[model samples]
Target: MIPQNIVKQNILDAIAVIHKEGVPKERESTKYHLWYNGGLYPPKYVISVANRFANGHALSRDRFNGGAETNNFLKRLGFEVIEETLATKNEMQMSEEQTFRVGEYYSRNDIYQKLNVPKAKQKGHWNTGYTQYEKDSFIFANVGTAGRTGHDHPNRFDGNDLIWYGRNKSTLTQSSIQSLINPEGRTYIFAREDSNDPKFLFLGNGRAKDYFDESPVKIIWSFDNETENHPEILAEEVNELEIYTEGSVKKVSVNVYERNPIARKKCIEHYGLGCQVCGFNFVNIYGIIGENFIHVHHLKPLHEISEKYEIDPVEDLRPICPNCHAMLHKRKPAYSIEELKRIIKDKVTDTPH
Candidate 1:
């Protein structure tokens, strides 16, 4: 029996503790989760962590039984345990046997076996980009970041947008493309921090926002559901200071750190897409193609900082156009928002001293 001393706050603290240490992928639940604060968490792990608050040490997994005992206990405390994720827009819902959590990570094979996807309808080979699990009316696009899989049909994320390209040497009429366009079905795209990572984040249920080109069709997917961050996936920036050996290459190595999209969105939401310094708005100039196309500038340079610190998007970052963003970085330590504003004002008025 759980100690009566253990309360709801203890469970919340446990989640924070686990998040800081990195949630163990192996311990994540495939079916059951305690849905709290709009995030899905493994119930057993929650119990284990919550015990640390009630007692000095974590309760051994052997001491407790799962399923009814755990579920009932959480229920008694006003916490709800559901199978995978909650549904929306309609009465649609995936069962305990097939549903997956949005932020949860799973390998390609694991997802296939868990959902019992049919062998006949599997999209194609692993390198074929998308796997169509028609049995569940879903298509999973296993995408690659920029150069990791080469320039050919690379699926990259632009802030909240996912820029994905269909398989090369294919047409828009293909089954996979049809599945994407079909309003009757759904699509889920997954990607990892690096090539070595085995599991991909179930990004979210994506709706087709825009599409263009052919042969290898380019599509933009927008997610209405919640999104999470992979810290290693940094934004696109030129490295001007790194040493280079252009010709003869030995063993190749690379390291990447991704800007938090959630943070970027928060900054944009607070400041809008208008450039803070020069007042240029991409959407106003470029139509639908340039919507949500403002560069974000950090008040403190990311490269100069060596420690981990919490970022307050509204306070620490601002939206700027590419031209203004580049000008702000023309000097070391970058220019202040006020300084750049003053410069722009002076230039516009032709009052430079």
Candidate 2:
């Protein structure tokens, strides 16, 4: 058996690896296996925090009978061992929610009403349609005609979507004419596929100056348009292109970073650095090295966010330890703090010595 201290370090290292590289695949276990002095350490290891049993080693089976002592040790360190894998359920829910949130899975006929296309203008094969106006800013919807705006017109292709040439002065005035006698220079361009696939794909802010000089206007489609640098242009141009062309219909997944600094700080401030599940305090164990150090977990899985919702950090977040946090996320929806507490109770009851 590995020394208790080394085992503890190994566990901590494994948790860190999970935080950095995500859950390791079954085949990739050796890649993340604990190693010391160039030799394989922790001969019996937990393959995945998300999976309970696949590689033959009992995840909950530990030194103590019924693994109570092991469970207790992990709990004290702020971790829990899960019993099943339910990440798929959570992922399926998230997939549906993401599709709905980004306006991707709407029906073909509803595309016109969903995009707020004018009733009188909905009958024709007009390549461009006007959507809603926000604060007097016009939002234009262009149905990509396989890179064709007019008969034999020059087109700029960017993956599956077409970048119709920019508008100059008189042309700009003509494009802005809605016959409602309301023309706004500030415009937003949203793109939809051809009439065959009428689902809107992109939304972008357009400025007259960018188009006045014939600067290439890439169609706006990705919802992840905001970035630290440029807020208007494609935040991740290449990645967005891939998503727009081929990736969106595939298994698109959101990478949820559980470590929310704002939420973490708020949780720690409200509850202190003590683990809410097992009352473990890192500073009490390791002195200055662990001061003000505690892992904050969202009571609700971060991957389930579908819209802009306010999270009350104190109520929605809690400070736990690495072990407990891992255990919480072991299952798809994650275990509640109260549920983990009950697991500790049951383990204590099972272990007499």
User: Which residue runs does candidate 1 get wrong by more than 4 Å?
Assistant: 1-98, 118-127, 135-151, 225-353
Off-target runs (Cα >4 Å) in candidate 2 are 1-257, 302-304
lDDT of each: 0.62, 0.44
lDDT per residue as tens, model 1, 40-62: 57788888898998787887777
TM-scores for all candidates? 0.42, 0.29
Span of ten consecutive residues with least summed lDDT in model 1: 88-97
Best by lDDT: 1
Give me the overall lDDT of model 1: 0.62
The collision pairs in model 1 are: 232-258, 233-258, 234-257, 234-258, 234-259
TM-score: which candidate is best? 1
Q: Residue 197 of model 2: what lDDT? A: 55
